[model samples]
Target: MIWTFVNNTFEPEEKATLQTGDLALQRGYAVFDYFRTVDHVPLFLEDYLDRFFHSAQTLFITIPHTRSQVRAIIAELIKKNNLPESGIRMIATGGYSPDSYTPVQGNLILQQQPLQLPDMARFERGIRIMTYAYQRDLPAVKSINYLMGIWLQKQLTEKGLDDVLYVQNDLISEFPRANIFIITNGGTLVTPAHNVLAGITRKKILEFAGALLPVETRDISVAELKNAAEVFMTSTTKRILPVTEIDGIRIGSGTAGPLTRQLQEQFIRLQESVTTAPYSRA
Candidate 1:
């Protein structure tokens, strides 16, 4: 019973439709946020919603519904889909306009599907990351502009890479899909301060890590990243994924470092707590 919430209507996932005249199709004018459900209950939904509305504001698109309305829609979608664990994507796109360049309305689309998580083995063994020297346009907004990353997908796939970490002017920005952090030998945790989307997982990690370590928010260089004692990435889907190899350079002992594992364990506890709450729908 897979379902999709499209323009406030619930329909079969396959039957869900959008108009070609929508600016989302004609000009790629859209904003999105992703969150997951545990036991059919949304996790960190408020945080994801905050980012979604903020993105809409930045794009000057007025969401057709209030946050509470969207939240209720999500609950209904989960109930109809019957997936206890899934990933939810909330999208607000520039709606149909006679002139493609103009934004007359915004369409909200909510989709839910299986939350495909990486294998636990990858978490234990760590993953390889490819580095590209580039900066995203409007780095703070979660827009549908993934042209650069999609362009580089072939190379990334050919080498069996896990993901990409974007860098600019010798400083690290972030990954195309996640935020990055490094643990220094001196017990300091460091991640980029600006020019990146401030991810919810990244924020929670910073909050949790502050109690366990000295956290620093500043510009981080690729040189420093390659030389760090440990490196990891955070996002709604990936959680905390350690980077064992970056651009052919082995990070630390080329395995998930000690502190990274500790952080992962702590994050799991936090995630478990968030997921166990009873949902009114399920």
Candidate 2:
């Protein structure tokens, strides 16, 4: 089942006022955010919503709903549909423009669908990753323009890899769909700085692991990763996954390291503590 919201009401599609070409064809002109819930309860929902609004502001797109309004709509949708665990997506288009270069108006969409988790064994055994030379056009905002990820996916598939990690000038930037992190020989947790999207899960891990170990946000080079003690990636869907190999080269001992497992355990415990109350029946 799916629930879609448009113009502050449940709908199957957008309003007739929005031009199809302007909203669908135009690239590099929109921003979006995705989040998942454990059991009909949104995880770090406020953080995700705030980022969504901020992204629209940064891209000069007008969000049709206030932050509180959006939150109320989401809660309504979750309750009406009896959604247990689901993924939510909030999108804002630059709207119908006379010409591709101009922005005339804006539209907002909220979509929710059942959540699906990847195989747990992949996290334990780790997955293969290929490196690609691609960088997101607007690193700060989560936009619909994803040609880079599409291209890398095809290339990585042909290379027999599960995913692709983008590199710029031999410095590891981020994975096509997630953020990258590595444990150096000195036990420092190193990940790319502000050039990539500030992921919600990444932020939580940084906060959870604060001062427990050295954590540094800086540009990590490909060579440094090749010799790192461990490597992993984080996202809303995949909380913490170890990268046992990159480009067919084994990472560390080719297994999920102690630190990665510890973080994953903590993440699960945190999720269980949050409660989700169903909407009261009328």
Candidate 3:
């Protein structure tokens, strides 16, 4: 029986429930952040918590627990669930609204479940994605509004695509769940800089990839992306996944490039270091 943290109380997952009038249910108004745990230790948990708080603030929803209190709850949940390798989600939803529109004190719910990281073959073979011309509302906030992305799943299955890369005005923005990166023919690394969620994996890549190659965050036109020497995406789950093809056009040699493999190795080393080290807020 899995344990969940809901409404300031710990309960069996089967017994956990939320009010029907929650804004998250009626209006789909909420914010969430997710991170994985390895060896029973939450990876980059502090960063995830900070982002959760920021998202809740941006949505005008209040999380009742303090930071330390939230941490305590998470630790307790992990203890009860006993899932060493797992994904943890922290959600703050606009509380039960009397009128079903106005925001009230929100509910902070935490859940844990076993996680399966992508296979090594996915990194080796890479993925193909289709392009879509849509921008998310309040792209900076981690809101519970994935309507367009969810609705496009049918197209993805029909088209045999892995994901959607969002673009606007001929400039590439991001994937629905990840951030895109490109290696120019001239050997420079580039990613989008505006009107997209600045993901934590994207941030860490920027920190380390600079030492490996020239890195830039700027608008990348579709023409530039299609013509790039290599392409890839970064996310909490996907990590540094290569984009072998875009819209049926192969990127470079149609496989993970040499530079991408190098960065992937570097990312794994960083993950191992974090996993073995003592958990710290620093």
Predicted structure with the largest lDDT when compared to the true one: 3
- Cα lDDT tens digits, model 3, 159-229, are 98999999999999998889999999999999999989989888888899999999999999999999999
Question: Which of 1 and 2 is the better model by TM-score?
Answer: 1
Q: Write the per-residue lDDT of candidate 1 for residues 1-282, one digit (tens) a residue.
A: 688988868888899889889999999999999998888888888889999999999998878999999988987888888888799998899898888988877998999999877778988788898899899999999999999988888889999997888998999999888999999879799999999998999988988988888999999888899999999998888899889999999989888888998898998899888777555334
lDDT of 2 by residue, 4-68 (tens): 88765786433323456665457557789999877778888888988898888888888877888
Deviating ranges (above 4 Å) for candidate 3: 279-282
Candidate 1 vs. true structure, TM-score? 0.97
Model 2 weakest lDDT span, ten residues long: 273-282
**Residue-level lDDT for 165 in candidate 2:** 86
Cα-based lDDT at residue 147, candidate 3: 98
Over 4 Å off in model 2, which ranges? 12-18, 276-282
The TM-scores, one per candidate, come to: 0.97, 0.92, 0.97
**Ordering by lDDT:** 3, 1, 2
Tell me which of candidates 2 and 3 scores higher on lDDT.
3
